[model samples]
Target: MAHDSRTPSVPPVRTQKLRAAVSSRLWPIPVFAVAAAVALGVVLPALDQAYDERFPEVLQVYLFSGGASAARSVLEAISGSLITVTSLTFSLTVVTLQLASSQFSPRLLRTFTSDRFVHWTLALFLGTFSYSLTVLRSVRSGTDGGTEFVPDIAVTVAFLLAIASVIGLVLFLAHLTREIRVETMMRNVHTETAATIERVLARKPSPDTDAAAAAGSLSGPEALAAPDGQPVEAATSGFLTLIDEPGLAAVARDAGAVVRINACMGDSVIAGVPFATVWAGAGRFTAAELEDLSRRIGGTVTVGFERTNDQDPAFGFRQLADVGARALSPGTNDPTTAVHVIGHLSSLLCDLVERDLGDRTVQDSDGSVRAVLAGPGFGHFLSTAVSQIRHYGMQDVQVALRLLALFEEVSWCDRSGAQRHVLQAGLAELREGIGQHHYTSAEKQTLMERYQRAQAAVTAQRGRPIY
Candidate 1:
């Protein structure tokens, strides 16, 4: 059977991070608020003037006789309520974040921080406050008994926004409360990971394509050691999150070089470390050429402080695994939650088992290998998703049983020999760990039965005894 190996359809890590950074910034919301405020500031006066010209009598009646004084009272009240609601929103948000951090993984804080709903909600209230204050300053009383001026429509809109803010506050509180629940958190993470998997590993190659890829794979290593090749060092330090294979290939094709990336996604690298090795055929590159090549290569990969799920499936697995591990910790001691996480992890693994997990090799139009990127294999993801949970939750019978069941479930999938071997080895380790532990006779029997069932499934699949 052809190896089911394909690249994930994720954006380059740097691009993903850049998009995230731009979206996560507070300035976007404020910019929106300021723009809205400015538009209203300019338009409201014109609207008031239109109202005055259209219905002078109605406008006169609407404008408060006390003019600026009456408008100030109304504006002050609206601003005060807004300020109060803003403070309450901030307090509630902080409390929710603290709860999420303490109860769940701190990494999840990014989810809440980058939440567009929360940002827009805060912007709504703050925007109204700014609008009210701006219009309030425009309120003017008649001097020497001239006509009083009050932006009645603007004040009315501000009041309407305050009312909306109150309703938003209610909705925000409900959403925040729902968001903190373990079920909600787990579901969100699972959905994101599943989407990442679908986007990254969705493609299933045809038999001909697979055969061609297998043929191309053989030619990759031979192209690595070209004459006048030099190692290129990383310019920055962070976790390597993405490798833009096509872009790298294009650069390599233009430079007439074969580039081999030394680092894999989700790996931490140091500055001045060998990031990639380039083999330029026949000629040596000048200092400027090397510098430009390095810059282009650097653009192809993204290194960040924390691993993101955009292009790294392993990072998602790691997040879910961490959640399960934390739940299993003595202080938390929540096996049920851990079990829930394990079920999702198992589902992710099953999906992964059917998909391709292989290094991405990009070639030029001339069929020359230009860039080779290392990606996580099924073994790495399988281990990442379960190993920590197995180690931490080894003592729990339920957790152990679930882990065994996971292995059995994956064994039933149309997996490769390597995948089956990994599953079989996991089962053996589980059995050994169970035997070494001090389980009750009943618990041991229960685990042994599950382990045997898993072993039998693997044995039947492999046509030999796994034990």
Candidate 2:
């Protein structure tokens, strides 16, 4: 119900879901690389034709001196080798995906798929292969009723590409090996989630704009209840991936309606399910206006097969939690890794506690609240980050203690105490969990003391910044 007045802002032209798709699944960049290489492959041969084997002395040394037969053989060899390498690369990538899914969590496939190293490696191999093949067709032999012609510069370029592809293969192998390590995977996840946090929360709102008009503030949700509103149904069934909040706000402003998004980022919606509700600004929307509004609103909310970090911070937390839980599972029994993961989770949760996070509202030029989006609170974030870990690590003191340390660290950052109850609830659960297991009286005493100290710190730190 609170009206956040702000200036006009432009929403993203492309949904983050699409961006993630482009990066994670492969193909887009390689397609581009192939196109570029093919263009170069076609153009350079023409230049060779222009030279007619009469190159300037300065360029003579740089040109391929091979006869047409040799040039054709070189092209044939390069193309053949690169295609083989490309196939090997794809097979290795598939195996890595399997290894990542089986050894780690299935969710980890996203991390592996999104790796630019792999993308570029594939791009190089495909590009080199396409380039060699394209240039190979341009080579001419006098025996075929044509002047003996060799694309000197083109063949030279192909030779260079073959070398680069060879190096890329070596580098790709090394990079793939490093990436599959649990430690490396977790670190990469932490780094990416940290970036998403900053991008979603840290942008300074321009003062010239209204109260809620911050650079990245429009990037999330803060759902406000819609007691009396019309249902805005979704067109498809899928997980909510991205929303163009600024666009939604603009639509609401135009229709003079208050757009209340009913679903949070990452929520599933079935076809015909109302993911949002709309309230008329004055009285009500005419049937035609309402129909158009529904269509536009549906367009702005993108549903995909899976969740993405684009606007959902919880997805990041979920990924980290999965890693932590997977590590603590008996099959893995890697308490050391779980401990490290908890440390990272602690960092993300602390950021959440210190942040002034809440609902994101977009206001119109008349200072009316046009859009209201719901976002996750500290409770959601804390539980997402730790619930599974706490459950799986209940019997492992190493995990139990690291979790306590996480509570302590988070307590220090939550000087406002806004998340005190959430922290307290987490501690209570941790306490109950420790008791469920056969933690000796001494271990119980130690954990309870730590819990009590955390409670005390939470109380004392209230209304006080630790800085």
Top of the candidates by TM-score: 2
Q: Write the per-residue lDDT of candidate 2 for residues 201-241, one digit (tens) a residue.
A: 54324446534355334433322343557888888999887
* lDDT value, residue 427 of candidate 1: 78
Point out where model 2 deviates above 4 Å.
Answer: 1-11, 15-18, 52-54, 202-227, 285-289, 462-467
Best by lDDT: 2
Model 1 alpha-carbon drift over 4 Å, by segment: 1-18, 55-68, 143-146, 214-222, 225-229, 283-292, 415-418, 462-467
RMSD of each: 4.2, 4.2
Give a tens-digit lDDT track for model 1, residues 22-127: 5656457856886797679668866875675575775566544446687789889988888798889889888888988888788777667777778888888888
TM-score of each: 0.88, 0.90
Q: After superposition, how far is residue 21 of candidate 2 from its true place, in Å?
A: 3.9
